[model samples]
Every structure is written in structure tokens, then in C-alpha cells.
Target: MKRPITTLFMLMSIDGKITSGDSDELDSDKDWKTIVGVKEGIGQYYDLEQCTDLWSLNSGRVMEKVGMNDKAVAQFKSPVSFVIIDNKPHLNEKGILHLCSWLKQLVIVTTNKNHPAYAMNLDNLSILYQEKFDGEKLLDELASNYKVDRLTIQSGGSMNGYFLRHKCFDYLDIVIAPLLVGGKDTTSLIDGESITSSNQLHLLSSCRLIEAQTLENSFVRLRYEVLK
Candidate 1:
């Protein structure tokens, strides 16, 4: 398959939990702001994220959680393009407009025919609708249509698992926080259906560690090359 080089990039806790808790009210972005130990190092994560791939892949739920729909006034222009997968139509029309204001390009991939992005006519916006979502096909489109050479995956845990299972992810860049937020139902770095049989053992993603750097305030930055 012809596709862009993809990297799974995220900031997670020591125990691999992506969110602070199961509830939307308790996300790492908000909860870590006031948390003592993790708070000090949170800036490092954002700083590193800003330096990642220009082609960013995210989820609508996370965007909504970050108040994407509430921001009416558009922000300053950015060179980075945002590719969001929103099957549930999580983002409203205003959110699509808000992204168009800041992003150099905004691509909305959805299974929903009534996505708010389809209603708009923006110069920077592109919509990709599919009856059934295909992880490999999405990467192919990003590489061919958008000319995205490198895509940074910042979506939810389920999306990460999709990429992993489909062999679409090439690298991993994770910043581990000092905290350890644990709950059986809480989201993690990779959350999806577990392999049911021994025949699927090869589906597990194994990687070779490229580097492990100890950042400030007990934060650790780990990079790995995913073995295909």
C-alpha cells in the first residue's frame, strides 16, 4: 500500500493511561493542569507536540472536548494541517469553521453523511466520506491526495489500535508523565478489542527503541521504530 510515514505521538501517564479517568470531565489536558507532580512537566509535552509532524491526525471527540465548537473567533494561521476522523459527527459547523481559520488545511474523514463539514464551502477544507472506515485507505489518501509525507497520530486510543492493527503506524513518540492514573475502564495508549486466539499473536506491535530521554520534572520521552 502506498501511504505516508505515520507516527503515533501522544502524552501519557506512567501506566499508559491516556486520560486521567474514564469520564470526559477528567482528561489529562484538564486534570494535569492542577495536579502537582505532573503539572510541572505538562509544558514539556506541549512543547514537543508543537515540533511534531505538520500533518496532524486527530479525533473529533478530543477536539470537542477541547472546546473546538465553542471558539467562534478564529485564531491565527498555522502551517500545520489537521485531519480529523469524526464518524459520529461530533464537531458542529462552527467547529469546522474554527479549524479552517487556524489550519493551513483541514480534512474531515467521516462515515456520517450529515457531517457538519460537508455543509461548508471553505478554501482550506476537504471532506472524505466512506461507507466503511479503512485505516490503510485513509493513509493512502493522505499520501496521494494531500501529499502528506509524515502524519502525526494524536487521535483516541481506539484509533491508535486501528492504526496498529492495520500496520499503518511506522513509529512511536511518547512522552510519559510522572503520574499513574489507573482504572480498568479508563482509556489507554492502545485500547481496542484484545486478540481472542493465539493465531493473532503476531498482531501485537513490537518496536525497537530508538531513544529514551529523561526530560524535566520527571517526564520521559521515548521514541521507537515499529517493526513491520
Candidate 2:
């Protein structure tokens, strides 16, 4: 049915350098602050406390952190139903089982059921085992079951790549922080092959949300439409 999704990205480094080529410099507090501020701002814009059909797609790593971190867990507990995607489905149970308590309908997307961790949480969580991972099909299932019209994609790199490659994103909300982390092996904000000139995104709008309250020190929010 071709459901539209909004992809939200929190990227580190002002120069678009998540990590440098050389694996030396790591851990930048300034960058982290910017990221947190942006999160807070986003939280304000949307009613996260209310239970709605809003669906969130996260990477495996994010799922683990969000499941454990009190703040993260609470954020998911609000209105949005979370769908965490991982190539290895087992990791979802092994790491982030507790946060499942917060989620109304916790969905895990994985390729196969090959790990011992997968067996433990069959009763507690909803598992969607796919022979092949297809984002479009996943969306169809979500809209059917959860009644979600608008979807958001939170990055964990490879998951972002899958959606990007499939041209599944409708809008992109990029929060760029003003800091740099210089290292080669550092995690990327998103993982995707170079989208060619033909696939470049078109700028829809760009605006700054001035941070009057909380950690946000006035961040720039850019919106783009993926030119599919």
C-alpha cells in the first residue's frame, strides 16, 4: 500500500564527520549535548505521553539502549508503538527485554529464528520472522495491524540503509549538531550506499527551533523530501 515514513536523523559533527579516518579521537561531550538538546526539542513538538498509533522504527543498538535507559524507555512508552529491526533477531531479546514492558506492542523484525535468546521472549513480545527483510512489506503489516498512517525511522545505520535503498522515506528530519568526532571506526549516523544524483533529496523546508528551555541551545531542523 506504499505507506509514507518520516526518517529522523541525529548526526554528530558539524563538518559531517561522525568519526575521522584515523581511529584516535573519540567521545565528544559537546556533540552529545547537541544531540540531547535536539531530542528534547523533538519530544516537545510531539505528544509522546499520549498513546497513539504513531510507529517508530529503530536499529538493534538503539532498541537495546532505549529498552534499558529509563528516559529512552519512557519515551517509547508514550504514544508511539515501537518496531525495532535487526538482521539478527535474537539480539532483541538478549538485550532489550525489559523495555518491552514499556511498549504497548513491541515488534521485532528479523531474518530468522536461530538464536537461543529468541526462544525466551515468545510470550512477552511480538515476533515477525521474515525469510527476507522487506521494508515495504513490513510497513504494510504495520499499517494493517497497528493502524499507523505516519511512520518514523530512527537510525541504527544498516536499517537506515535498507529504507534508503528501497526509497521508502518520505520526509527526513535531520538534526545536525555543532561538534566533531575524529575517528575512523566510530559509528556512522546512518549507513547507506551513495544515493546517486538521480536519487538526491529535494529540500522541502529548513527552520531553526530556538532552544529557550532544556538542553537544546537552538538547533537547526532541516526537512527534505526524498526524490523518488
Top candidate (TM-score): 1
Q: Estimate each model's TM-score.
A: 0.98, 0.66
Candidate 1: regions farther than 4 A off: none
Q: Per-residue lDDT for 108-195 in model 2, tens only?
A: 7778667334676544467677888888888888778767777777655556666666667766655555455555555565565655
Candidate 1 residue lDDT tens string, 1-228: 479888899999999999988887778888887999888879999999989999999999999888899888475899999999998888999888899998999999999998878779999999999999987888888989988999999999988888878777889999999998889988999988899999999889889999999999999999999998
Q: How many residue pairs clash in each candidate?
A: 0, 1
lDDT against the true structure, per candidate, is: 0.90, 0.55
* Residue 48 local lDDT, model 1: 92
Write out the backbone clash pairs for model 2. Answer: 20-183
